[model samples]
Target chain A: MTVGRKLWAIIIIKIFIIFAILRLFFFPDFLNSKSDTDEGKGDYVREQLINRN
Target chain B: MIDQIDLSMVDWARAQFALTAIYHWLFVPLTLGLSFLVAIMETIYVKTGNPEWKKITKFWMILFGINFAIGVATGIILEFQFGTNWSNYSWFVGDIFGAPLAIEGIMAFFLESTFIAIMFFGWNKVSKGFHLTASWLTAIGASLSALWILVANAWMQSPTGMEFNPDTARNEMVDFWEILFSPMAFNKFLHTISNGYVIGSIFVIGISSWFLLKKRHILMAKRSILVAAIFGLITSIFLVGTGDGSAYTVAQSQPMKLAAMEGLYEGEAGAGLVAFGILNPDKKPGDGEDAFLVKVQIPSLLSILGYRNTEAYVPGVEDIVNGGYKPWFEKIPVEEKEMTYSVAQKIEKGKLAISALRDYKTATRAGDSILAKISQKKLQENFNYFGYGYLNNPESVIPNIPLTFYSFHIMVFLGFYFILLFIVMLFFVNRTTLEKKRWLLWISLWTIPLAYIASQAGWVVAEVGRQPWVIQDLLPTVAAVSMIDTNSIRITFWIFAGLFTALLIAEVMIMVRQIKIGPKEGGSK
Candidate 1:
């Protein structure tokens, strides 16, 4: 392959590694995982906010 | 509602975010400006029907691709961090902040991504005109992406067009147009993009200067320098104007930041601009010690810059924290003043606002609409100082003054230097004496890193200057972090630090290899 295609290949692989593997494993959304429903998430955030001194 | 919070977690989370942001920035400005510079080169190539121009365009495009790819890798992590490390910040201001980010993803990112493919791969397959259009569109799309993100950032710096909703426990967007067209947003977008343009020009000229020093691609180096120097000169001048606009906005909206940027302890009418200074390490807001150890200042410049009047009052850190100084009118030339609350008074108002919000929430839960309305009204009245409620002391409001002051001065100093460098470069190139000026060539080559330093320093001034506020006046950063364990953030920070450093090394290696290969071997056309 040409050098251009090689660079493109690296980019695609990097994205897949970062988003699909690393993000899913290491960086799950905190609020989303805190509760199953929107109301629960809202309650979680509200509790965190109000309880801060 | 929750257990005793770990203060260490908050500090670690901040460190993680700062790490990601600073690293992300290293690559982003290059992509912002280089895309446009490459497009400009391509336009010249097509118009002139010159193969040499095509070679130059293709060569630069390769480097742009390298920087753009790595930049995206770092950028995506920053967004994810909001959900991971700063979930509370995300949830609190999600309704308002998410709009710009979502639009950035849906519109600008998509536009740039689509055109970038054509820009890279459709060279021989597409007509020259179509390819050129794609190139231009890619550049435009990158800038549009910057626009939305910077607008969101500006809103954080100067929160507007949002209302705190007690029922939802979040700040919600009330006026989309107001958020989009805020004066802070406008200046931020212009300043940031001009900064990008300047970085791009510097990068181009810097690399071209290397070629001239080596006595290879002599013609190409001269042509590239000519274009880049002209572009750099114009954008550098524009960057100065935007910087001034930024200072004025900061003075009007974030006086604490302005005070910190100057390290001013005791404010006065017609405060001079600090041309250079060393901060007194022992100085505190109310302390009688000198704020600066040694200093040189341009008389009345700070007043003129901040308030557009020679004699307009500029507040010091002490004045802002202890409060007796009147707030100048937002309109330039400062015709009138209004009474301003001290930090202590604002904290009281903030507590009232917070209490009212709680009451409003409770009333809503109890289905008492009348009580809820009254509580909401009270909350609204004091909501302007809501973030201050979380602070235990007025001293917590002071950001790291030394960092902000130094970063601002460094950025300003480098900005003027860039204009001078460009003028000298243009003159030498025109006279065909640039290659002979070995010292100048070395200076030009070294400027690539200085451009990066200047760009990063600008962000340091902006982000570090407005410390303790994730969303200006509304939210404290300590309250913004997710309630996750500190160890997790610490681990991730190390992981990211190691990973990003590796990526940066690989990028530099690849870029160096490409630069060595030279334009003849770039082989696009």
Candidate 2:
């Protein structure tokens, strides 16, 4: 392969590893499990801001 | 895209958006500016048939390509983030905000993307005239993109051409043209793009001055410096007018933002402009303690600048919160607008609206038509300030004052300083004095970062001053996040930060190496 092709191959692989692969394993939606309804979610937000520990 | 209504959710989302915007900005302004510079150089090359000019154009073109590539990469994330992080905001204002973004994609993106290839690789593949057209089109495309995005942003600051729909729980467009050509949008576009022009000029001058310092590309450096300085000087002066127009728009549409930007806590008819001041952090307005630790001000200047009247009352944060600015709100178009809400009155009205929405929901649940109709009337009447109802405390309405105030002042001070620097440089440019005056060259070289900083500060004053509410009176940021893990957001923020930083380092290294290589050596084989 040419140097240009070699560079492109590594660049694509690096970006995929960092952005796509790591994201799936590490970042899961935690806020969804916190509450069910919108009102309950709103209350949680207010309490966090207004009555913070 | 679900509502993640929590503080950490909001914080992490905000952090991610801010990080992306900050990184995106570091690249976008240069692309905006350099594209035109390269186009101009290419035009010169085509006109004069100078191989030297072609080489010069190509050198800058290479830098532009590197910058544009990263800018495009960062920009996609910003657009996507509305769905990923600010899902609620997307749904709420989607009817209004979605249109401009769609236009930008269709109009600006296609034009830029199509022509940019020709600009970069079309040297001998396309005819000479066609190549020049591509270069110009690419520059115009970059600018056009800025216009559409600013239109959307400015609409958020001063929401015109849209009305609240109680049924949909959203703001819908009433007049497309009103939103597109809003006074706020026009001012923002002009001010922002001109700032980009100034940034471009400074970038060229700064890099050119560096070449002069080392005496490497002295002829090209001198030519670049002369060209950029003239362009810089013109735009720098015009920025004052555009900046004034921005302040006026803010005063008329977003009085609280202007008040917070000034750190004024009390209403004054003839408020003086703060020249320089130290704000006393502990100072409270009603307590009668002066907010200024040390202040020097031009009397009545703020009132005149903000309201164009020495006697026109400028309402401060305290006045706004305490309902003293009711007249100001009443003055905003017709009292016919459901949105003409003063500070306390807005929250009260918003709570009523919220109550009505609940009632409507309850009535619907019971299948009671009559009750639903009654609740709908009340909901529609007070729907404008519904976002304010989410607030538990009135004080939450006040943005972080010191941050807003300092950012505004820093932007202003640095702006005037740039103008003065350009003026002095313009004076000495033709004479041998420019090269002899090492101090000016050194200052100009360093001022590049400050120019970028001023642009960022201007945005800070704008975005920070409108705090709590992401859509002015329409939506608070707390209610605008996607349902996601705080760690998820945190992880993404770090990932983006890491990637952008790595890319930036690589970019700087490449740019530096290319710059050192000079146009002659770096020219295409």
Candidate 3:
């Protein structure tokens, strides 16, 4: 590939790493997790965001 | 459903989405109109072989490139957010909303993305006719993508041709044509694209006027002004017509939103439009205090605009809460058809829907077919106002009226102001006459930021007016959010804010530098 194409590829890869890959590893899918019951999960968010204040 | 949504999570997710949308908008309007403008210029150049038209087209093309890049960057995050921040909403309407987005990718995005490459890279490689076709196709592609997305959004506001699939626990499309050609969606697409057209016209006029002011590129700037003025004027007229259609739709599908937008607290037989008014801050629903502080109203205009006739009843906040609109739905046969349903009635129905769902869940697990059947029947019957079940208080249905009321007025005022601006520009602008009128040129230059403000304000009116609803009466905004920790969203929100801000600064610096360079040197950069 040409140098221009190579540079564009690297730029795109860096963006993908920052947005997609890093997010998947660092930000767990709290919503989809099976550890908590539906009510327990709902209550957790409600308490943390709204009723606490 | 008994519990109110996690307010903090919803608020944070909304904030993040708003940030992304606002940033994305900054680039989209320019891309929408400027692409077509550039194409028109190129068309002129090819037909006449005018070097001047080629230079003008190249100059704007550079700016469009700068704007389109940032728009795409911000746009990807917004799409990702549908899966992350609003997972519940995604699941609920995925069967319906996903179609348009998919079609947008297959039809609009491919058309735009393929041709845009040809437009930029195939300048000398392809024949002039082929290149011109690519340019027009790119613009059409961008517009078609917007059409599908707006259709999806409009479905949320006025959901039509869709049915609740109780077995699947989501809405399913019964008719694709109905979804695509809903009157509300059609009007929305027309109105929104016209808005983009106006923005593009202003951008061309503003930048060209700036060049004129500097006594540089006077001839090219004049031609640009002439084109944008004629185009802008025509679109501005259409913008007003579609605005009327939007108001009419709000009256029919989301009356509560219209009531909030007008700051009307009590139903009236002949309601007048608020020509201009300050909302009385102390006044709220159930309070007897007058809603507006200082006001000017056009008698019966709202009634005419809302309904075709002046005598048609317009429900207000009090009417909504006290059961005015319930009577309209009573003609349809239902198990719970009463003379009228107060706030209490709606809440009971909403609670019934929620309870029925819970029973169905329990029955399914226990393998109790009879119980599941009974509960599913109840759930389907009262599912119209399912979002209402989450409200702790009946009064929670009222949107933030002060914000909606003012936003709607500000948008309207600016819209009419733009028409006036367009008329003045069109009348005064000539080959050389516009060059001399420094004051008019100054107005054209300053009108740029106001055009942006008006566009943003129009969205505010639309979104804020809907209030509690994420999908009209079907889903509340709070319940639609993913059950994520507020802190997680907050941290990312700030990160994106900083990142997008930096990109914006870079974009502006590059744009300003290119504009300063003029056509000859700027095109290469």
Candidate 4:
């Protein structure tokens, strides 16, 4: 375990974590469909209340 | 009309926050304190040319590694919760809240993770100086993480560096520095870090003492206790000071929170602080049935802490609840004419009811006693309604008071106990042999769980006391939720529960493996 090797190991870990985080943020659709359904439901509830009023 | 639905949402969100926050805290204190311990051990090795110091560092690092893994796992869920349970709040305040979180991930997480890996696996690879530098950087990274998280949370409590936007219905940050240096942020960051230092120091001292008592690693144990004691003393004192500052800030900015924390009911000059109390709001404080166990009264303590004067007015629960003090809304002025008309109608209705009852009594005097009794019952019910404001029984608005009360007490009691424990350890280390005191060693071992309990109680108090409010007075918790169906929440909750549980178990397994291995055998030389 040389200094250069250690540095490389750390760098690789960081790259992986960062990449995962970015992918999760960008392609959030693949991870979960609940977010979209959540948004739709919120809008539906608000619209229903408005219509009743 | 929407209150019931809103209340349920608030409760659910609060429960989720409580679970995550408690679990997150279980690891965070150790991270903060353990980082410092590792840095100190490495420093001692570098200075004293002792392989034993290296061994001490390695052992604690193993525990630190376990804590870090769980901390990271729990922390991820917390961030997701902001979106899942509190989606509206995220949308409303993300502009302000998201900044610190982003900085924490970018600046602190990278530094921490990078250095941590090097420190863990780079023993034979890096230069001595480079290795030591990695350890120190990791320590700094942990502190920086605390700083950023506290900044975000403190901003929520006190609201700094932000202005209200009518269009977005949210607060937007105006200045980064303002948010960073806000009084709330400063106090909370210091207080939290200090607690971390205390926890970390106590843990090292406890484990080292255990080894010493067993006659294994006596020399290393002695050094570890000495280092821990020094840190323990400094952090103990710092914790007290920072706690005072935090309380003072809460009194100024979040008076309702301060009142709830103290359980004050009536306004008074130099009010007595409740050390222990069976808080029954249905009865007065000294009613003998539901009274506080008054242990000690430091006169003018609250006033001095809050206002820098002994006579400053601290508003009580009654004032806040019944004084018509709306937090974020303007008071509407009543029209005198409309008010008079309403009052006259109420009075007229009452007079007509009284006359009808009197007539029924007179008419039934010589005939039916049963009819008269029925009329009297109706009259009494109507009168009681006017007097009590409603005939219908309102649903209970009370919080789970007993749980809140004891959780609060447990936290406070631990705070004081830890203060004394640290003090005693410091004294023994400075004067007598800390190793000889078997009783103190055992106590230190037990303080490990005490730290976790205190951390949990703090979370319980914050989330539980806030109750219906997700954003403290501005937004109700239920209104802040994502409009997803109950089934959706249930599904995600289970998924998260499974994932977190697996991560927790994995973390524990790794920690046990490291501890079994003990310190690394080879020396750098």
On DockQ, the candidate that comes out on top is 1
RMSD of 2: 4.5
Residue B484 local lDDT, model 1:
87
Q: Report per-candidate DockQ.
A: 0.58, 0.12, 0.12, 0.07
Give the alpha carbon lDDT tens digit for every residue of B1-525 in model 4: 233354444555566666657656777889999998899889888888788788888778767866775556457667776755666667656467888888988999999999998998888899878989999999999999889888887876766676543223345789889989988889989988988998898888877777767767777777788888788878878888887888778776666566666666555566656666665656443233433444455677777766556766565555444433322211333232121112233333444434444544454645767766665565544431121121011111123444555676677788888878877876886655777888888888878778878867765665565444455433445446654445544545555555556556655666545544455556221
True contacts kept of each: 0.56, 0.01, 0.00, 0.00
Evaluate candidate 1 and give its CAPRI docking class based on DockQ.
Answer: medium
Please state the Cα-based DockQ of model 1 relative to the true two-chain complex.
Answer: 0.58
Please report, as a residue range, the 10-residue window in candidate 4 chain B with the lowest summed lDDT: B387-396
Model 1: per-residue Cα lDDT at residue B100? 92
**Residues B1-525 of candidate 1: C-alpha lDDT, one tens digit per residue:** 223667788888888888988888888889988999899999999999989899889889989998887678677888888999898888888677789988999999999999999998898889999999999999999999999989999999999998777766778899999999998999999999999999999999999999998999998889999888998999999999999999999998898899889998788999999999999998877769888899999999999899888888998888888887786654633346556788899889988887887788789889999999999899899999988888888888899999999999999999999999999999889886778999999999999999989988899888888888998878888778888888889888898898789778878988898888889744643
Off by over 4 Å in 3: A1-14, A21-32, A35-53, B1-5, B325-340
Descending-DockQ candidate ranking: 1, 3, 2, 4
TM-score of each: 0.97, 0.89, 0.90, 0.76
- For model 3, state the Cα shift of residue B338 in Å: 8.8
Task: Give lDDT for model 1.
Answer: 0.87
Best by TM-score: 1
User: What are the clashing pairs of model 4?
Assistant: A1-B125, B277-B292
Candidate 3, residues B1-525, lDDT tens digits: the string is: 326456777888888988978877887888898888889889998999988888888888877876776566467677677767876677678468989988988999999989988987888899999999999999999899899889998999998888875554567899999999998999999999889989999989999999999999988898888888888889988999999999888887888889998999998877899999988889968879998889998888888888866766688888888883532222354345444466667877877887787777678769999999998899889888777776667787788898888888888898888888778777777645788889988888999998899888888888888878889877777777776678878988887787778667866777777788788732444
Where does candidate 1 stray beyond 4 Å? B1-3, B330-336, B521-525
- Fraction of native Cα-Cα interface contacts (under 8 Å, chains A and B) also present in model 2: 0.01
